[model samples]
Target: MGENELAEQFGVTRAGIRAALIDLEAQGLVERIRNRGSRVRVVTVEEAVAITECRMVLEGLCAAKAAVAASDEQLAELTALGRAMTKAVADGEPVTYSDLNRELHARIREFSGRRTAVELLERLNAQLVRHRFQLALRPGRPQRSLKEHLAVIETIEARDPQAAETAVRAHLGSVIEALRG
Candidate 1:
């Protein structure tokens, strides 16, 4: 659908749809055609692998550091985020689960207490967002993700940096396998 039709379908104005489309295009979610209008971009498998690989390294490091460095409040926040993910998964709310899952990982990165690492991770994160698989929310996967994340959190809570890192690496490895299959 064109901008006007999309706006009408969603009960919004044409201008609102136009602006949203422009924003999504800027974010690489929509590809603008010279004459054929915009289309949703499909993320290829290779792109997904690359994004997951980068995230595995950066976020693994974050989990390790956060285990060693995060303050009590920070840990609490992370735990709360994990619980939110768990609830979403249990409820089979894919959209909420995916969002909370991302937030959980981002929170770990944020609480790592390393400015350089956080900045680098955030930059990588923006690029990876475009490649995120909606299938991550497939009924069983979110619950599995919650369990893996809880393992990471347990290590973090114990201040076992190496264990936390290993947990994240293993979790991400599973994700890679899932993506391949």
Candidate 2:
């Protein structure tokens, strides 16, 4: 968005538009080119794969911690989510499955109680929205990921930290492979 055009369209001052764009840029949602103004940032496949590599470690840690730290209530909710996700996939609803996929990861992070990792994962995930959506819509992707996600939930529910971490790592490793493709 051009600063002046956005300001005029939104009835905000130029400074306000500039400030908004600055925040978006900091969040990796927008790219500001000197004279070309700004546009939604495009994350290349290579970059997406690299980001998923980082996510593998953080998410695996979160899964392990969530296995050890999550209460019974949290575990029950995760189980419910897993059931809903399975239904979504069986019903051939990729969009619903994709939304549930995001929720599953976010909830796992929340239950982990690792604030720093959660915050960083949130930032990294925000940048991967387009790529994730694309991957989720691939022919049999949701079905495959459902098994992976259920493995995660099962390990967490069983309170097996090592298994939970391994499940998460394997899930993200699959994601990285998809992104690479």
Candidate 3:
């Protein structure tokens, strides 16, 4: 949609839409085409894999740092979130599971105490949200993901940074493979 239309639909100013579009364009999720205006960029499988690979490393770092830096309260929160995700999966609510999944990761990043890495990972995550959500819809994927998430949380709770990193990388690598399939 045009900036004016988007602004009207979102109840924001034209400048707001323009700014948001600029950010999206920078993230390679959208592009401005002169007369054609801005459009959602089609992500190829290769591009998706690249994004997933980047996420694997960044998130692994986040998990590792979180293992070392997270307070007992933060660890409890993660455990609760993981339980909630398990419930969501058992209820067969993919949408809820996906939302909880994102929240769990964000919580880990927040607890990591690394502002720069968290910021970069958040931006990369925004770009990957669409693909990630689609992947979450695949049969049995949500259950598998919940199991992986719980395993990561277990490692974090154990205060094993290396194990936490390995768990996160393995989870993200599985996500990349699923996306490829």
Question: Would you list the C-alpha lDDT of every candidate in the order shown?
Answer: 0.80, 0.95, 0.92
Task: Summarize candidate 2's per-residue lDDT along 47-81 as a digit string, tens digits.
Answer: 89989999999999999999999999999999999
Better of 1 and 2 by lDDT: 2
lDDT at 124, model 3: 79
Q: Give the distance in Å from residue 66's predicted Cα in candidate 3 to where it truly belongs.
A: 0.6
> What local lDDT does model 2 show for residue 18?
89
Prediction-by-prediction clash tally = 0, 0, 0
Native RMSD of candidate 1 (Å): 4.3
RMSD to the true structure for each prediction, in A, is 4.3, 1.1, 1.7
lDDT of 3 by residue, 1-181 (tens): 6889989999999999999999989988898998888998878778889988998888999999999999999999999999899999999999999999999999999999989988888777777777888988999999888889999999999999999999999999899889888
Q: Quote the positional error of residue 20 for candidate 3 in Å.
A: 4.0
Superior by TM-score: candidate 1 or candidate 2: 2
- Candidate 2 lands at a TM-score of 0.96
Assess candidate 3 and give its lDDT.
Answer: 0.92
Identify the runs in model 2 with alpha carbons over 4 angstroms from their true place. Answer: none
